[model samples]
Target chain A: MLEGTMTSTTEITHLTFDVLVDLLRKIFVRHGVSETTAAILADNCARAERDGSFSHGIFRVPGYISTLKSGWVDGKAQPVIEDDGAALIRVDARNGFTLAASALARPTLLERAREQGVGVLAIRNSHHFSALWPDVEPFADEGLVALSFVNSMAVVVPPGGKKAIFGTNPVAFAAPRAGQPPYVFDQSSSAIANGDVQIAAREGHSLREGAGVDRDGNPTTDPRAVLDGGALLPFGGYKGASIALMVEILAAALTGGNFSREVDWSQHPGAQTPCTGQLFIVIDPARGGNGHFAERVAEICDLTREAGQERLPSDRRFRTRAETARTGIPIKAKDMALLQELVSE
Target chain B: MLEGTMTSTTEITHLTFDVLVDLLRKIFVRHGVSETTAAILADNCARAERDGSFSHGIFRVPGYISTLKSGWVDGKAQPVIEDDGAALIRVDARNGFTLAASALARPTLLERAREQGVGVLAIRNSHHFSALWPDVEPFADEGLVALSFVNSMAVVVPPGGKKAIFGTNPVAFAAPRAGQPPYVFDQSSSAIANGDVQIAAREGHSLREGAGVDRDGNPTTDPRAVLDGGALLPFGGYKGASIALMVEILAAALTGGNFSREVDWSQHPGAQTPCTGQLFIVIDPARGGNGHFAERVAEICDLTREAGQERLPSDRRFRTRAETARTGIPIKAKDMALLQELVSE
Candidate 1:
């Protein structure tokens, strides 16, 4: 159910996850991106599928190609370290792609932590490429604790207000455990991201009630209601607002970038704003060099797991990725059609 | 109007807030505390009053005195720094009080931040003594961004489960600004804290519908039902659960102390746990010699204030504190009665 002149005449095809990722990588390489950069973007998309986060997956391939074609994202842009002292770093993304640059810049933070005890990375002036979970996963995969946040364009409304004054303000935190998957928690402060709403609209699905509101501040399930400057509701009212504010401070304020309302990442073709920021903090357990550290972490997570039936956080996703590596990735007809058109083009 | 507890037997003459605080300080000294430590505890209580947090104010004097007489907390015990580095410091509270020790230890953190750009202070074997905002406001006043959290006894249910597996874990963050007050946001990650439920119970008032659940996982408005082995829902469902989990890891895991299921700060004798942990992190905006950092924080607060009519975080309490300083402090009759007994003793 997307209305208006949004029409489709594309063909549909089902491709395996690896083949699709390879195809997407080739497309990114053809656009002048370096090999590492292309792989990072492609890996991000594949990980999105693995995590069941399709909104940020190959679903966005068409948009990515168009964004690059419009010169909104630089293919050859590089990130330069502006400051690295006292467990802090300021990285200039050079208007490059965010996922690629974040992938490149995150290890520098870990390197600092290896030398010292803790490290922080702040990236400025970057473009969106894919899901943020992949950016912080490696830190947890190693023996480190990590917290990362990215501030996007304004999509969520403040508490007791109707205006869209904050992005979904995505946040993710991960901690390592010995002999088990890391406990990774990631979420958007809003009930749902506007990107998800767009995906639903594209796939002709009705959105859940209370997920969004109309331009006049009336609650609506119609994705179109939230797209045209209508506000997205934050999850859990005041607490959600507090989280949104926290993300603003970490991702936008501390990093010296645009606040929520000043940035533009809407799906529209003409919108342009270059002021985005992100913060990544990594703490190495070995830097502190405690012997009983991993044991205690395992104890806590084991106690929690015994308290319930759920597996460790991201365990399901890790298992799913393994299964998807064996089987083909399931895709919606609409998404298949769009990817096919992109592959042909 | 409290239904059952408002009686002449519990009423006492009104005393100035300063007089009440002086009485508590004198008692602390009598129970084997130094004058300096006594003053810090009393001063923290007094500042809580100024910050308009009555529940964390002098109302807890009897509990402090009871714990002292019972010997669950050591009055003369002092915190020793067990480990020290530029980025991290671990302190053992020696079964002593947390308030005075924490207040005495925070300065060391700020001092370390002067050299290291960031500082962390972790305390184990401490007691809960005062409001969170009081502990963090000093850092903000000194132009540093501060965040702190403590894990309490299990009273909150984790997401998707009915068991009381998480505490009403509270995390507080304060950001400094030149023109406006430090934007302080302190909240318990529970639909309702036990303190609020106690107030409702004493007042014979029905609880909020969704605040707590009865023992059988059924929602109830009965405060007593929540207090007696029942669970308070996590604030914002999965978001609150995630936040509580974050606090647990950052505070307990980082500090190597007991977590939610292990914390016990109750005043009841023979039922407490000496396994409390606290985490404090301070970031110096002056580390980079960024002179405009404070004012930039002010700009963020101003934009938030301008964005809506809702008071900027912690605005009303600050105004209340100013009013109390100008006029006289306000105290409930039941609280005054307890204060009178303590002063008389």
Candidate 2:
């Protein structure tokens, strides 16, 4: 499957889910990860690809490998869960990938929520490289409302500041329906995600107004400026900034982890994983005694859908998931070759 | 305090907290509320005024009086709290003001959170006619992170629709610091709160771009259009819309209360309070063993305040609170007259 020379602007080829996951597994295992850990991480990548999150899929594999190679992430370390309280589960990630810790923590968290109406899971010392929706969607599938917050490396500037203060902290919420797919939404507090800005720079696309600012705090629509010393502004101005601060406190401060400002990237060079944090809160709606929870959710979906050309949140993602499931996921030819090369190395 | 005529831009007169609370207590008493319940509601009004939330202060007293007169809100009713689970307190508000119910449920809620690391209070069959911050700030004062969501009358439209399908649902969050006042924020999901739009319409002021749309779904900056046969748009487009939907589910549906769509305004012709719902979640930072939570919060505050010309979320509110406490709450003469008239009636 020799696709042409690796170029930034290359045509894409379809890859089966099995084949893509297999390649990711091989690449992770080649970097000295346990086969089980590699499989878990690879599953996360496959889900990202299946959901059309190309940036978080194969695009992030190299970064994960780099972190592992630099000894910034433990490939074989197991997560330890502590019952901090009746409704709280604190997960020590043991300096490994967050996916492993989250995988180990979710079932217990859900069980606690089911028994106690609400449960909170705080993960510390983990490297979260995957999209947040996957972490919360499973709880929603079990008929619970789930919210997830994660603080990453600081790349987003505060509302009026020139320097980066908060990470592109993301908040995700998911709620289940009776028969339909759950209502799920995952969004970064930044005006635009760094991954999207990088994609625009690579594709020669101009950003919309207010996407980011130059180094001197002046507004700019140039994606390259946002990537080079410039910082992405929060969405909706100060409102987004406030939410980011909340995430930083809840994920980093409350979880006994490093804040975005505390993550020193220079100490470990390229792809060095930061000691990050994640918080997941799951609530059982049944405890509220609202017997028709599913019907109520469906009604909301109907009202939102009937309100003009608007689509329900995560509708597009579910559609893409269906499409990718039928037709194979399309990967850039260059990315396909890079994955193979990483495994071979 | 007879300072001005009842004009659109009437000057206001200062009313001492004692006088204002006394007036509110008398009005509620005249309307047949129990003295304790009246005192609770009066305290809520005073806090709203002290915090400079005039829309939720005396400005809403007439509505409360009207609802009581219309026999929609049972002013003498008491809230009942049920321990649905280890971490959940379900409050049946008994068709009364939510403030009373919240006051009744708060102690248990705080205790539950302290014991279990998290607690949820779901309030049902209540008229939550005031600001959301008051519901969460008390928790924050007790060294807990708090979040509250409430759904009200349908006045805001969905993202693409011309008609209002959702209320200007509000979400509030607060976290405590050692020396500083708790970091607090209460924001409506709409581009602007309905009261602000009403004030702008009365003052003949144009709204900011993307505030709302006219009857035909054309974007308009005219506040009158938004108030008359038009609908307010959600902030940040679909992201705000999604949050509004979450509030609807969590507040109304999950609490076995009425959604904005389910509220039949025609049935309750004038000032009859619809049974609204509120949900509050509190988390104890001690659960995660994060001892420096206050310092971490302060660091975030410094970063945001130092970044630019931006004020911290509740800084202005705290200042207003201090000013109100010192110089007394300023109330429009006409509103003062109305309150007196209601009490006399």
Clashes of each: 1, 0
Clashing pairs in 1: A1-A204
Write model 2 residue lDDT over B131-171, tens digit each, in one string. 78888888888889999999987777887787688888998
lDDT score of residue A188 within candidate 1:
88
- Docking quality tier of model 2: medium
Native interface contact recovery, all models: 0.20, 0.71
Best model number under lDDT: 2
Q: For candidate 1, lDDT tens digit of each residue in B1-345?
A: 222222233343333557646766776777556787787787777677656676677655666776777767777777787544646667777777676567767767777667666777777777765667777888889988888888777777776566776777888888887887787887888887666787688778888767888888778899889888778887777677777777777767777667778765565575332357788877776554457766767676666556552866688898987776665565667676565566567
Q: Best candidate per TM-score, number?
A: 2
For each candidate, the DockQ is: 0.37, 0.66
> Residue by residue across A207-316, what tens digits does model 1's lDDT show?
78768888888888888878876878888777777778777876767776667777654544643323478878776654443555556677667765665526555667
* lDDT (10s digit) by residue, model 2, range A1-345: 533222223587777777778888989999989888899999889889878887688778878888887777789989999885479889899888888988888778888898889999999998888888888888888889999999998788887788888888999998888789998988898888877887799899989998898878889999998888888898877778888889998898788777887787565656645678999989998885767888888888788778763788788889999997777787877887898799899
Worst 10 residues of 2 chain B by lDDT: B1-10
